[model samples]
Target: MAGFDDITKKAQSFLQDGKVQDALKSEKAEDVSDKVFDGVADAVKKVTGGKYDDKIDKARDEADKRIGNE
Candidate 1:
């Protein structure tokens, strides 16, 4: 239910949190990133009345694919 920026901040904090990163190590990075960011994008789209939906969604996808695949 949080906004896109909030989600992004949370994700950044998650990466810096040792325990969370450790837990994430057991999962597929690409799958996890995609799932998480995709949800963030959806939430953002819902709140913004679709004004920036395409751009936000596209950025989310690119970030997910690029970062996850790396």
Candidate 2:
């Protein structure tokens, strides 16, 4: 039976072929940058007491580009 390894391999293959990226570029997924990354960056900043806000925002912008939202 298929298991976690099979799922992981399939997911990796999909990412390698840019399928996941294309999917993320869809209109439904377009707001993922603000909806997801903003919360992530906020949490990181809170954890670090806001010391890394600038760096976190920069990294978040880079990640947003990867997700096709930038």
Candidate 3:
């Protein structure tokens, strides 16, 4: 479906964004905790009415992992 394809493209783009990855590797990012990311993801999921909860969770996990403090 067109919607699914668009979602896939966005997901891939996020995953491939070196700038975001690099930013997440910064010292400030490293000081952030998984709990904070999880809280933010939860807030985002709620704001989106759970429509993009899966994607939000995946992105949060990826970002948290990039910080390398989790």
Q: Best candidate per lDDT, number?
A: 2
| Number of backbone collisions per candidate | 0, 0, 0
Who wins the TM-score comparison? 2
Ranked by lDDT, the better of candidates 2 and 3 is 2
Residues 1-70 of candidate 1 have per-residue lDDT tens digits of: 4698899998898788987655555447767877789899999999999999879978986776554444
Task: Output the lDDT of residue 23, model 1.
Answer: 54
Please provide, for model 3 over 1-70, each residue's C-alpha lDDT reduced to its tens digit, 9 standing for 90 to 100. Answer: 9999999999899967998777666666766656688889989998999999889988987887767444
Ranking by TM-score: 2, 1, 3
- TM-score of every model versus the real structure: 0.54, 0.71, 0.51
Residue pairs with colliding backbones in model 1 are none
* Cα RMSD to the true fold for all candidates: 8.0, 3.0, 8.1
Tens digit of per-residue lDDT, candidate 2, span 1-52: 5798899999888887766777777766768666798899999999999898
The runs of at least 3 residues in candidate 3 whose Cα sits more than 4 Å from the true structure, single-residue gaps closed, are 1-32
lDDT for each of the candidates?
A: 0.77, 0.81, 0.81
Flag the better candidate by TM-score, 1 or 3: 1
